[model samples]
Target: MGIDFYGVLQVPRNCTDLDIKKAYRDLALEFNPEKLQKENAKHVFALICEAYDVLSDPLRRAVFDQYGEEGLKRGVPGPDEFIKPYHYHGDAMRTYRDFFGTTSPYANLLDYLQNPAYECMTKHGKMFQQKQPPITHPLCLTLHEVFFGGIKKMKIHRLVYINDEKTKTEVKEKILTIPIKPGIRPGTELLFPEEGDQNPNQTPADVIFVTEDRPDETFSRKEDDLLMIYDVTLEEALMGTTVTVNTIDHRTIRVPITDVIYPGYEKIVENEGMPILDDYPRRGNLVINFSISFPKYLPKACKELFRKGFELAKIGGGFNQYETVNKLVLADKILRVDFNEQLPPT
Candidate 1:
């Protein structure tokens, strides 16, 4: 049977990347190969490490999802720049000793609970030794591409020392596609092995994906929620019409307005006695506001109607009035669309 990454780590599929890393570190430290002398014990520990290697990498996870373990074994193409590397086997074993008390495979972890050695192991040592790299490299990625998942390829240059002389060398750099789970906040980093210069003494630096929001797209500032602003005319607002709202999904969803429609950006949804917010009884409202604008290239008759009916103020050399901050205005004129309200009383 294939290894189950989530199952091996004992974390939910939706668990954050940091949570997954922590889980792997805890489990690996407990069952490190160096700590285990028995063949079976070492075999099981290797499986855990393999699982971590695949799951921790976004690209490897993608490969695993499609081709399983056998597929990921295929080599990824990149330039072979000589790197200073460390033995992963050594690091895993050292981490195992640090997290759990017994480095011996034969040592019963349960028994360690009764002994004092267990405390010493976890408390005294660092999980991985830190070594400085002779040179540093930089990489950058976009927010959406990182969140939805994508690939990043770059190159790093390193200086090689020959007889105390430096020669510039370049290595093909590849960060396989990462599959970022939903609801992941930005500023999360993913790490890889030996990802540094010639004297690769440094622990792999994390690929931090920072979150950014586009101004035109309305998105929820919080988890498990969405926000939008709608503009309606005085007639539609009073008549309680069906407003077809274009959503982030690029489709229109019709929502009904009520007799309580107001002129300003009104919080139609507020807490129902929730102590954290004002007791407005509506918990999740898309504050609908009202506004007035004239068709610039209006027919002479329409311009006459606006001039005769409403009060106007001067704006950019044109007469206008302060109204609700109309977020849904399209250029030229607003589309005053009233979706069909009644369907033959069906």
Candidate 2:
């Protein structure tokens, strides 16, 4: 007597397709070599795979259901009087990979239970040697592009096979349009599944476009915040100054400098940064860091005036004169001072 495939899989002959799949999945998991430590695990797993292969197909199932394994080996005659050989070509590991869409044979059983569609053969089909890995391409975008969402079309060249034999291949250019959302962060990935290389025996790999923020000349980003460095003259650092800033949206913003501007001073303009992702109205803050520029060669009279001004300010008894002097002398050939008491307004 031949082995009973239905008994091996714990499914009845009258069981539905879905029931058969479920039973096979259970048996496969129980006999998986990675999960089971029994001596005959490998043999049992092979048997489970063979059972699924024969029962999953309508023609083979009908042959086994009627004349059993003997009929399967001797071949069954179709209505057209042609005898079709019943053979199992599926590998146990490959079956698992096709079900899970991954190469790992040690898949979590709970995952299969939660989403049975993940193991649906109709969805992922099967895996073959011609299967290729996903192709990842970098999509470089400017800060301005990220600020204002738009659609961009990219041109890509993909290989196209000429015939089923795959004897010849041709390169074809395809235009792919990608939607860029507002405040799209770097490292965000967009996937075009099964759009990679073409082969006769296997499904194509996925084509992935990964977002990357290109280095901008004027701005740097921290999430939704925009940071920029503004150069101010030495005279402007002491007195008040006004700066005209060109925003990402092509708007001109006047940033007034009323308080004393020190080196590393940051001025924040709220709601003027990058747009919040998915929340168009909401925005982050624009941070402006100040850099003071001083004349390399100052006249003796100008130095005397500056020294007198410092001495007079020191007489007021509110500033640290010695630290201020040291900073002015060693300040990258320019006066650089940190006024901790003069903090930026929230």
What is the lDDT, from 0 to 100, of the residue 4 in candidate 1? 71
TM-score of 2: 0.55
| Root-mean-square deviation of candidate 2 | 15.6
* Candidate 2, run of 10 with poorest lDDT: 120-129
- Residue 263, candidate 1: C-alpha displacement in angstroms: 5.0
lDDT by residue (tens digit), candidate 1, 250-341? 45666666553555634333321111122222233334344423234656855554444333323323333322112222211333434364
RMSD of each: 22.3, 15.6
Cα lDDT of model 2 by residue, 1-346, tens digit:
8778899888888998877777776666667887776779988888888888888888888889988987886887778885677766657877766655654444544455654533333322221123467889999999989988799788888888987767567888888899999999999999888787775435578889999999998899999999999999876776658988999899999999866777667899999999999788799999999899987999896687568657865985746444454344445333334567545779
- For residue 129, model 2's alpha carbon misses the true position, in angstroms, by 6.0
The C-alpha stretches of model 1 lying farther than 4 A from their native spots are: 1-169, 187-204, 218-220, 263-346
Cα error, candidate 1, residue 338 (Å): 21
Candidate 1 structure lDDT: 0.46
